[model samples]
Target: MALRACGLIIFRRHLIPKMDNTAVEFLLLQASDGIHHWTPPKGHVEPGESDLDTALRETQEEAGIEAGQLTIIEGFRRELNYVAWEKPKTVIYWLAEVKDYDVEVRLSPEHQAYRWLGLDEACQLAQFKDLKAVLQEGHQFLCSTAP
Candidate 1:
């Protein structure tokens, strides 16, 4: 059986006079262990928990962003399958935008640091191709959905 996990591609829009894709930024947390790679907050699913619930819980536990502070984007979900620790793992991600542009991010011990970065910088820091692709896809989704 594949190990399943879920997370949110959390982003915030700058309060700019002119709104554009450039004014959007993604939140990525740097893991304290492993290779210290950066990625969105996520964790393994616990028994009886829905995927979205796990994502919300992990986001709060890892990044300290409460569910009330985010607006989960509809119709935008990405799933990636890979091998980790000799086992098949599947990760599901949904896009979420911070309601308050100035909301703070408090990281837990599992992550050493966090950054809100633009699409290009975020993809660079994400490292893995699949994760970078997810970030890019989320960016494009947000851009296309922007009014």
Candidate 2:
């Protein structure tokens, strides 16, 4: 079976009049292992855990962002498939917005560093094609849905 994991693509928007999605920034965590790849916080789903629950749990564990700290944006979810460690892996992601623009990101031992970046830099650091695509999609989605 393919390894299944879920995570949130957490973002925050700067508060300013006349600002666009350009004010938005995404949170990425650098893994402590394996080429030190940077991606949103995620982890394998445990037995009996729902996909969304796993996503929330992993975000809290890896990024120290509690569920209460962000609002999960509806209507924006992406799934990516790839090979990792000689095994197929499926990762599901959902968009979320931090309630506070300056919310703290406390990284766990699983991750060595974290950054909040705009779309371009996030995509560059993402490196993987699929992840870059998802970040772009998420950015567009936010832009289109901005209030």
Candidate 3:
């Protein structure tokens, strides 16, 4: 069976535009182990947990962002499948917006660092094609739906 995981693609919109750029920024965390790759907060699904539940739980554990602090965007879930460590891996992600842009991020020991980046920088940092595509799609979705 493929290893299944779920996570949130958490982002925030700046109330005041910074440098006249798009007010959106995405949150990314750099892992402490393996290749030290950067990704959104995610973890393996525990027994009997729904994908959304696992995404919320992992977001809280990995990024210290509680469920109540985020607004999960409808119609923007994504899934990616790939090989890792000679095994198949599948990851599910949902788009979520931080209710407060200033909410503190307390990283767990799994991550060595965290960054909030704009779309271009985020896509560059993401490194993986699938992840970059997800970010792009999420960004477009938010832009289209914004007031």
After the best TM-score superposition of candidate 1, give how far the Cα of residue 18 lies from its true spot, in angstroms.
Answer: 6.8
lDDT tens per residue, model 3, 68-106? 999999999999999988999999999999999899999
* Regions of candidate 3 where Cα sits further than 4 Å from its true position: 16-22
Q: After superposition, how far is residue 97 of candidate 2 from its true place, in Å?
A: 0.6
Candidate 3 local Cα displacement, residue 56, angstroms:
0.6
Candidate 2 global TM-score: 0.95
In order, the Cα lDDT scores of the candidates are: 0.93, 0.94, 0.94
Q: Count clashes in each candidate, considering only residues at least 3 apart in sequence or on different chains.
A: 0, 0, 0
Tens digit of per-residue lDDT, candidate 1, span 56-144: 99999999999999999999999999998999999999999999988889899999999999999999998899999999999888889
Ranking under lDDT, best-scoring first? Answer: 3, 2, 1
Clashing pairs in 3: none
**Residue 105 CA displacement from its true place in model 1, Å:** 1.1
Model 1: lowest-lDDT 10 consecutive positions: 14-23
TM-score of each: 0.95, 0.95, 0.94
